[model samples]
Target: MALLSYPRRHPSIHLLILSAYALFLLPILDGLELGGDGLYREILRDETVLRLKELGKVIAFSDEEGVRFQTTFLGSAAVAVQDVLKLNSLEGTANALGEVRYSPESVGSYVEVHIEQGPVLEALHYPLAAELVLTLETLCKEPNKFLTYDEECGCFTEESLAGLVCTVGELLTWPSASNVIPGQVNFTVDIRAMDDKVRETIVTSFSRLVLQRCDDRLVDCAVEQKHAAAATPCDAELTSRLERATRSTISSMAAGVRRAGGETPVLMSGAGHDAMAMARLTKVGMLFVRCRGGVSHSPEESVMDDDVWAAGLALVNFIDQNAVDAAAATAAESDVASGFARPHWSQAAHQFGCNRAP
Candidate 1:
């Protein structure tokens, strides 16, 4: 704000201040640091918990910054701890503050709080994501389901198979998007939860979706689904290993220009992250530091000054968008995503959206 201060008395000083302000805004207009925020790290775990709430399994909380996951039992205990400490927003604020500020080693009796080894997003994005994910799998098994293939339509459908692909959201969810990472895209359907019924449903639904898509497109599909299926849920045996979620984000830093121009999608990743380490994830996307937006594994988490200011402005814009309803958007996007070809049984283009009726 001081940057906006008036300095009418000193023209030279005013010039310098103006120069500094311009420098701070450089990243915003020219480019932005493209790194992952804590959001991706927690998407699966968080969404899993929410989806499984109907079952016996329970998750205490989740955020985009995947960290600080606790099952129903532990989550209860943590809530008690929060009440005892009179900590409002304890889970998020404490962890967030811990990461940004360095602290001294526990000094005698007093707990010393200082900046963590590095920035919050870079340090805990992946680890927190892992914890949430592992715990979630322990809860259940995944189900795979697909629509019955319609021989007459030559397309998969429950009743009728002939029609446009769809105008609703396609929900092009990529499993292990990383599989396509340095190689061909790999997909997986994960099911976890104590409720066998739910697990079966998830697996059934996902498998069906994959098969349906593949069948619709004449592509072969496979199922690589698992839940914390082992006898022991928490033991290392039940572990769910995932790639560092930030790789994609870090690589995206090159889009500083796109981000500045608002061409970049300011969307929230439905993933888990090392957010629990910093303890906050829900709105962490709002805090992208903008400088480094680099590889999240390094101690030197940073961003250019310009990037930070740009992100600051961008954040405000993004918050305004939250008011938009997701279901509506999903429906709209599904239509857009599944621009299926014209639906016909005789002869026509077979692409996702090739032929048309009306």
Candidate 2:
């Protein structure tokens, strides 16, 4: 891939969101801002929704590895996002911007966690809006709901999420804390997984955990739909990488273990992306430009030259040797697809099949 003079392999949302922000200048009169996604409700006449908090995990057990062996709580990130954006909180609107109905039992009390969005190109110099939201939402109380619940604690046990790890890679706990309304609230640790398979598994597990809270009823929490990217089948090289991920020590040490059901260990994210999304569809991978102390989703999100160069160097290494093979393979396939020019592996294109010709 021919990169610009900039070194970063992956562009940040903080940097790219400017295009989204520029839309605010349009004359729709209201909204037209990127950070103002909440305004989409007004633009579309959707009502605002309120955020409910009612779930948290009280560790039932932990192994020597210190991994939480059980889940005592669950909640919908969608609902929280809805509240944070104040999408449905608006009164008297016909349609709610973020309306959701679910057994409050499913997702326990609400606590804040980071929603990583915006461009990955931005540096880490600015305030991390995601973190700010994390700071704000965790402090929100459910008034009378979440603080009270009755259950036979000894009966419920959390299921291991071995299956979910297939789509994601790194799962981590941010035991970091923040103050929302100073002197009032703190935060809980978050376990984040980055592998596509692992992420899918985590999402599935989260759904089920909340479902259990629903006491066996159909719930309508906000769900993540597949991204509308130009998706195609996963490539052979990517398939091999996914297979290796399954055997990786990380997968073996997961909380729960399940047998694969002929599903690919890798998956494409509908939204959250990095090299993972690109890697799943093709041999394309991404290198993240930093978020200056992890800031994003605000106008002030940022990063630095050093970080961009680091990302670029990693990207260079990934393609340096594969470029020639890529082109040779393209040309070697006796029959090139209609008008497509066979590429040299050395090209190591960003397009991979993503921008394959129109």
Candidate 3:
């Protein structure tokens, strides 16, 4: 109840304060880091929001005369520290590292429309898939392991730890000379899985392996958890709506196009997105459009115009359907509350002498 209360006693604001914590509905309002795909993705989000607004209704109801509707969207303020450190010197960036002040509470549902960014949909011959979950992790080591003493060998051997590199990307060894024994090595690890348990197991094993190898060689090993994002799951009820929307709009595009029952699969996102951050606040879901060759973030990556249209239509349909269902349910509850319907247990109460005065 504390989470759902509106801040103001406005006449126009009718909040849905359910113990299930049904709150704001989120749509893909914007996209960040606009590579070529980013621009297209933003267009899709803007258009979907615009169409929903034109429907002349808001997802949440209000008792006030003129309440403005509000929906949550992902904000780009939570950029990685490693990325920010690259552009500007760390001198004036202390304030930037402070906690995020603007997270909304108890999100009802989230829907993001974007290019699939992977080859799964294309391989499956389906135009769309709901991204049910995401996985990500980060691993780190400090100081330097090369400086560690070897009692048996007695001499510094650089070739011994050559095969110990697990994460290959962005590895930097200290001392920028050909003749120097490398004293420090820093690298990053990124992984994704649909299941949180699976991701946890992988991270645990990886960390254990790194420490064991370092201990065996008598190297001082330190691991710093730079980032760890748990897998986010889509709400089943909303996911069902997405599936239906996809079938009605995307499946009906061409006649006799076999839209198999289980053909349009639900996928787990390997790449991280703002959805992962939003998951902390509320429920999240995603609609994926097929990407050509499953290629993304490259010049060769492409998406068909037809697929884009289908995605937009599906989004519009989902929003409309949700509004209608919500309004009907609200009206039904209002009627029951007004004493239009009799309780089935009323007769039983009377028989047991438990009936009270009206």
lDDT scores for all predictions?
0.25, 0.25, 0.49
Query: What TM-score do all the candidates reach, one by one?
Result: 0.21, 0.27, 0.60
Clashes of 2: 66
Q: By TM-score, who's the top model here?
A: 3
In lDDT terms, how accurate is model 3? 0.49
Give the candidate number with the greatest lDDT.
3
Task: Give the higher-TM-score candidate: 2 or 3.
Answer: 3
Cα lDDT tens digits for candidate 1, 1-358: 2233222221111100011001000000010124322222122223222222222222121222212221221222232132211232344555544442212221001000001112332332311111112112111111112124445866444332121111221135444474563323454344443333344544677678878998998876676532223111121211111112222222334433322322222111112222221121111111223223333323444344333323322222221122122234445667663422221211111221112121
- Which candidate model has the greater TM-score, 1 or 2? 2
Per-prediction count of colliding residue pairs? 73, 66, 5
User: Tens digits of per-residue lDDT for model 3 on 261-316?
Assistant: 55557765655554555565556677778878766545666887656666766665
TM-score ranking of the models: 3, 2, 1
Deviation (Å) of 94 in candidate 1? 21
RMSD vs true structure, all candidates:
24.4, 20.4, 16.2
